[model samples]
Target: MRPFQCLIIVALFYCPLSAAIILTPTVMPLNIDKGGFAQFVITNNATATLPLEVSVHQLLFEPDGSYQSATEPAATLMVFPPAAMIHAGQKQAFRVQWSGVSDLPASQSFFVRFAHIQLTPATMPAGLRPSDTGVNIQINYNALLHVYSDRQRADIVLRVDDEGSARLTNLGDRFTYTNRLNFEAIDSEIQSQFETVVGDQFIAPYTTLVVDAGLTLPAGEYHGREIGF
Candidate 1:
């Protein structure tokens, strides 16, 4: 099991991001039955105070193993402190609550965008020095969140793709994170044991990942499983 996980989706982002904000708990895992609530802390590291805007986007997993973002309606997910002005080195708490969400396909996931609200010059500190302006630019951060059905669990499916390449698919709801993958393949009389570091890759449910073995793995019986989360 990985202690922390992130996502790797190739898509055109509908929104922009800044670099001034840092979010703890980069990923959110929720139990749809347990009040469906999760929290994240936003910290501003810039020298100037930042006006922060918190928002959520529905993550649509496409067939080609990519994700598309759809803006979730404000009423769909209740977020507290949706807007706040955070001073440099200050922290603000935000909460996301999901209620009465049904008719979902086993489960669903979204991304929380910690966007930056431009700080007007008038809002800037009077004591700002020239160096300060150069150092404190707004940087935004994003966190992945998932709301799962009670049946949400991880199911790993592997298939041999091109030479030395394999495809890993998660057939269950929720993000299946693994620090290491144990699988083997062989070509000709040469056999090799290989491990792929999935990293913080949070593979969305019902999606497939083409894992490159970096070598020519022949067509043969390949076996392994996700060692842990």
Candidate 2:
């Protein structure tokens, strides 16, 4: 009898083939006082040229916090290079400009969608049919683009937990950044307290955040705060 061999395989599914495209600082902040302009950068990390279709979408946040595409155009924001190609190992900046919409509210948001656009001037495969000609690899990404008239001033309310998610609420007009969470815990049994620094994260305006800071406080209290770098 012969012994049988086993094999294991891994795959990168639903990802761009030859993907070398990346958008840095995914979370962007816009200051209307700063001339209503923000910059987003895309770096092509692949060895082949990267093609993309970039467009801006207006957002309407539902009562349940889920947002949907709005018919109202993003008249305030305009992104150039709606369609472009990036050479391998190169970087490109997409400028987001505001057309000076009058009486702008405290804040407004948009979703910048980067879609795959295949580029081929002349190429054909053997026995290619019309249906096969339309086939191309799909690779895409997007980012959260925020344009606000005011800076973030959070009125935060925090709740502590030892083994579960800690809750935080912002009662202010501005959103609280999650990356700024700090934790201090006092163990009732040992009577000890310690502090920690959390990374940059965000909580929307009038929204709540539930996070687990991995604090082991048995029969004790926990406290969390935010820090600005």
Candidate 3:
């Protein structure tokens, strides 16, 4: 658990039409559960009035691999202030609760999208700045999911040319860092324990220490349940 205070920088410039607002998570693929509760807080940093649409939509990937959404079409999730407005530089918080169960593919990742609309109203103040409508919007979503089997470990093999010849060694205490894989850690406490390393070369579990000339590669992608001593 962490106390989060994220600062989003959005530049507002003078424009003829409404300026496009940018919204995203500090990290990719904000995690949430299928049947859970989530609360999102939207901050209005523009110098003009803002009308935002709060809802969820099918996640879409942008040309450059970013994400964007305008609204939610017939989503089962319930959101507060379904259609509302926010003042310039002011902040508004909303709560959302989803009631459904979804089964994601094992060892796979997925994503969902939420949209916010900026609104301009006819109620004009006596003196309001006419600058770019750039505003920073941050989402704080929270969800709860039923815990599945919490004791599952994956046995991944790090091989060279798909051959069964490779070396293995642990990096740190309870943490095994290997090569050739970019793994993103979610809500799991991960650590690698260093087993052993033999000189510049690696030793295989129950295999020869030498003879092939070049040193064998490293294999540390496999994981298993920790057996209590």
Candidate 4:
């Protein structure tokens, strides 16, 4: 008999192909005025039992339009049942509460990581075993969690360099979410246009997000405009 092997897949966002586990409300918004906490549901769609581990991390962004996750202390946020074993077709409710300072002056962002642990015949329920192929797949998902106060607001500005490269800077006290950017420039009777459609992305406060304008133009000053905030 072949030994069962586990393959792990990590997805920054939700995985559509694997329905073994489903997490609802990929974007969770918590208002400080409304208790600064929220709930998320995880459903097991796989035929076999699933074990899940939950964790939270601080979300950070780089100037080059890239982002990373930083380790967050447990006292900053509270999650109930950080790990659980869920049966097939069963739904589990998880509660997240903010245990940090209650008087937050701005909005904060975090990533909720849900990992589906490896499965084996020994861990499976009675009468359940791996197929003859003896293979199991594990998946990890990262969900966005935003905690904001009443004073949260976004002030975004667009700037274009002499080479026509464009970047967006958020000067406000909170993050700005946008999906599209539109800009046009003119240099000595020559008009250059640039536009890009980026699916949901956020510009954190006091950070610059660089985007590919996809156009090369003569050296000149260009003013960029953002569409559909």
The positional error of residue 229 in candidate 4, measured at the CA in angstroms, is 8.6
Q: State the lDDT of candidate 3 residue by residue for 185-229, as single tens digits.
A: 311322221222222221111222211224233333433233321
User: Mind giving the per-residue lDDT tens digits that candidate 4 earns over 60-152?
Assistant: 655453555686644577888898888878999888889888677667777777777555766544454677437664557666788877776
Candidates 2 and 4: which is better by TM-score? 4
Off by over 4 Å in 1: 1-20, 72-75, 100-104, 122-139, 161-164, 180-193, 197-200, 215-229
lDDT (Cα, tens digit) per residue for candidate 2, span 66-141: 4565555466677886677887788888888877654554455666766664534332122444366666644446
Better of 2 and 4 by lDDT: 4
Candidate 2 stretches greater than 4 Å from native: 1-18, 58-73, 100-104, 118-137, 159-166, 181-200, 211-226
Candidate 4: residue 99 Cα off by (Å): 1.1
Sorted on lDDT, best first, the list reads 4, 1, 2, 3
For all predicted structures, in order, the TM-scores are 0.69, 0.62, 0.38, 0.70
Best by TM-score: 4
lDDT of 1 at 178: 40
Looking at model 1, which ten-residue stretch has the lowest summed lDDT? 8-17
lDDT, model 4, position 166 = 61
- Model 4 regions more than 4 Å off: 1-18, 72-74, 122-138, 180-199, 214-229
Q: Which lDDT tens digits does candidate 1 get at residues 63-85?
A: 44577667664456778988888
Candidate 1 lDDT (Cα, 0 to 1) = 0.62
**Cα RMSD to the true fold for all candidates:** 6.7, 9.8, 12.9, 7.8
lDDT (C-alpha) at residue 169 in model 2: 64
